[model samples]
Target: MSFINYATREIQLKIVYYGCGLCGKTTNLQVIHEMLADESKGKLTSLATNQDRTLFFDFMPLVAEAIKGFSTKFQMYTVPGQVMYNLTRRLVLKGVDGVVFTADSQWDKMEENVESFNNLIENLSLQGDSIDKVPYVIQYNKMDLPSVAPVNYLEFLLNNRGVRHPSIIASAKTGEGVLETLNLVTRLVLNNFIKTQTGRSPAEKKNLVLM
Candidate 1:
């Protein structure tokens, strides 16, 4: 759920990036944090192991355009992806409004990708949140790697859900598709909020869509 502060005229949405260990979830956040103007982003905070793998989560707060009279802020997070950190992953997902599932594209990591996705479903269910209802986008990352799987194959493996959510092919290291993935998820989250709060149709709220 999104937090709305009328007195402060602000709205904060939480977006979590989830995937297997070393799947570029942190890289996506790092790229966004570095590219964005300092005024538009908060300090990038990371709790990582000595080897630099995320131990808990990476947090980056970003300010977007105002919606109605409220300033829209997105608190971006990346869950620790190692299997042993399942508890930490669930804790990070407590109140996410949107998600970006970053899948490792290397062929060797296919099984890990599927396992992490199943873990995601289980955690969301435990929190009483259905994956189908959440605003999310799948990102096949590490595309620049030579051993990456084909996009079509990855889609069948990870995105063959009842409804196909938006998916993007990305190389987080090179910054490809990072912003596109972020923009799409953010739009979905805002659109959902508009529909629920105002009972407005897509046509009625078309103008408010982020470009």
Candidate 2:
């Protein structure tokens, strides 16, 4: 988790980007890092194989403006997408507060996307967390490609698995929907953190919606 200590307030959160190989997880990070104001971000560390390939993980810390007296900090990370890097992927997911699953939209990669998503769920379970309990978002990446899957088809597949997480259509290369996805997941995670820390169960919070 990332921590922020400024005077009387403190906040911490960890968000991880997960997806299949070449699904643009790293590209998302690169774009965010470049887009943030210099004062709002720190050096990005990319630990790669052979110093040229992003084979392990990439970490970047961002300090967002204070919100209602609390400073929010995000420790964003990207997991290696290769199946052989399963151990590395699990390690990066440790202590994650939020997840952004970037799914490749290509028709040929449909099965791979499904498998990788299930793997993420299984890994979360092993870490004592479930997909249903975590603040997660989905990014249907590569939307600019002509051969990409239909957005409705993707949403239907996700909903079939009992996941109601918010999904966004994104093209990392063009900076479309990246910040929107990030903002949505960040808001969800922070709001959930506040509720839980204040001893409010998620179900209780939902019930109060009618009041």
Candidate 3:
């Protein structure tokens, strides 16, 4: 979650990118690292398997000036997509402030996507977090591919599984929808952060943070 320091007037948050194997989770981070101004981002650390799939995680820290004397920073991460790395994935998600689920849109990976999504929920539970209560977003990746699952179908599955978080259509390779997804999640995470820190009622916090 976002950390708002009344003394320093700073807000720091962790945003995690999660998905199944080869679902473009790492690609999303690469795109951000490339697009952001060098001065705004920090060192990126990545651990990969022999085949180059994510092994541990990819982490990049970004800082942005906030309005009204408040500063905001985000430490972005990508969980290893392979199931063998489940332990690693679980480790990275601890204390995450926000989540972006990058689902592989390819039709053939439908089952894997569903299973991975379920894993996200299970893992979050292990961390003492409820998926319904977290600040999260879904990214349907590889939208440019012809064989990808239909948007409507994916939406239906997500809804049925109680994954009602906001979603974005994206092709990480081309950088489409990347910034929009980030902006949406950042705003939601910040709003949640402010609410928890100030101890505002849910409705009051929602209204104030959205403003």
Candidate 4:
């Protein structure tokens, strides 16, 4: 659920970046943090462990109309993708309005990607949210690297669900598809939020369009 502050006139939406270890989640955040305008973003913060790290920050992305005079704010997070950090990942997902599942495109990392994705669905269920209900997007990251799997194979592995999500292909290290991923998820979040807060649902997209 997004937090709405009438006094400050802001609606804060939380979006989490999830993926397998070293699958470019952190790299996505770093590139996005650097890309945002100073006036639009907050300080990037990181909590690190010997093997993994968690990152988060807030930014005002005025990509949508205000809700009852409240501006839109985004609080983004990246959980440690290693299996040992499952607890931390679930904790970060609490009250999340949107998700970005960043999959490593490398052939060798495919198994880890599937495991992390299932872990995601399990954690979401434990928290009373299902991927089918929650708005999310997929990012096939590290596309610039060699030995990457075909998009169709990766989709069959993860996004083959009855309700498929929008997916992007890119190299986060080079800032490709990063903003588009964020924008898509946030749009879904906003539409979902609007539908929840109001009685009507927003118009749906035409097809499984990749942003």
Candidate 5:
């Protein structure tokens, strides 16, 4: 659900990054935070363990494009990638307007990728929300790794949801495909919001691509 502040003419939406530990969820945010202008983005805050892996979430708020005279602000977050932090993950997923599923591309991480994706679906269902109903994108991260699996195999493992989502191949360390993934998901979130507010058919939604 979006938070609309009528007095301020602002709309706040949440977008979460989810995946197994070391899948580059944190990398995505860190890269994005570095790329964004200080005027456009808020503090990039994270709660992590001594080793620096995400323990709770990474949160950053940014002002995006406007919608119908309302300022569009996005609350970006990343849930802890550890399976033991499922409770924290569920809490971060509450009222998410969009999601970015960052899958580790290394062949050895395939199983964890699939498991984490399933965890995402289960967590969403526990909140009375379905994956089909949410705006999300898949990011095959760590593509620069020599041991990475092929994109097709990775797609089969994570995107077999019957409804294919926009997926990106990225090397978070290299800053490749990070913003593209973000832009696509934000576009989906904005389109979903517009559709619900105006009752527009999928095809009728405007193509408002974010840079």
Candidate 6:
């Protein structure tokens, strides 16, 4: 859910990057933080272990186009991908406006990906949200790897559901498809917000896209 502050003319949205351990979730945030200008983004903060694995989450706030004349600020977060951190993952997902599921494309990580995805569904259910209703995107990360699963296979495994979402082929380390993934998810979230605020479809709100 997005928080609108009328007094300050600001709107805040939370977007969480989720996936199994070593699926490049942190890498995605790192790439995005590097690509954004300092003036447009806040510090990239991470709680990681000695081995540099995410211990809890990585957070970075980014300023994007305004909505309804209010500045839109997106707080991007990456949850700890380790299976044992499931509780931390659910906590981070408490008020998510959007999500980007980063899947490890390596063939051997398929089981991990499936388990993480199932965990995501269960966690959302616990939070009183439905996976079908969330504005989300899937990212098949590490596309540059030689022994990765085919895009079709990944899609079939992850998105064979009632509503398939926008999916991207990404190499977070190389910055391939990273911005596109963010842009699409941001757009999806903004469209949903616009619909809720204006009681009209996004296409009917041309001014919403203008800023």
Instruction: Report lDDT per candidate.
Output: 0.93, 0.86, 0.86, 0.83, 0.92, 0.93
Kindly provide the TM-score of model 6 when superposed on the true structure, using C-alpha atoms: 0.95
What would the per-residue lDDT of candidate 3 be over residues 80-103, giving only the tens digit for each residue? 888888888889999899999898
Backbone clashes per model, in order? Answer: 0, 0, 1, 0, 0, 0
* Candidates in order: C-alpha RMSD to true structure: 2.7, 3.0, 2.7, 4.8, 3.3, 2.6
- For each candidate, give its TM-score against the true structure: 0.95, 0.89, 0.90, 0.89, 0.95, 0.95
Runs off by more than 4 Å, candidate 4: 50-68, 204-211
Number of backbone clashes in candidate 2: 0
- Winner on lDDT between 1 and 3 is 1
Clashing pairs in 3: 1-97
Q: How displaced is residue 164 in candidate 5, in Å? A: 1.0
TM-score of 1: 0.95
Residue 163 local lDDT, model 6: 79
Q: After superposing candidate 3, which stretches have Cα over 4 Å from the reference?
A: 4-8, 161-163, 201-211
Model 6 over residues 145-170: C-alpha lDDT tens digits?
99999999999999999878899999
* lDDT of each residue in 156-184, candidate 5, tens digit only: 88888788889999999999999999889
Task: Kindly report which residue stretches of model 5 are placed more than 4 angstroms away from their true locations once superposed.
Answer: 201-211
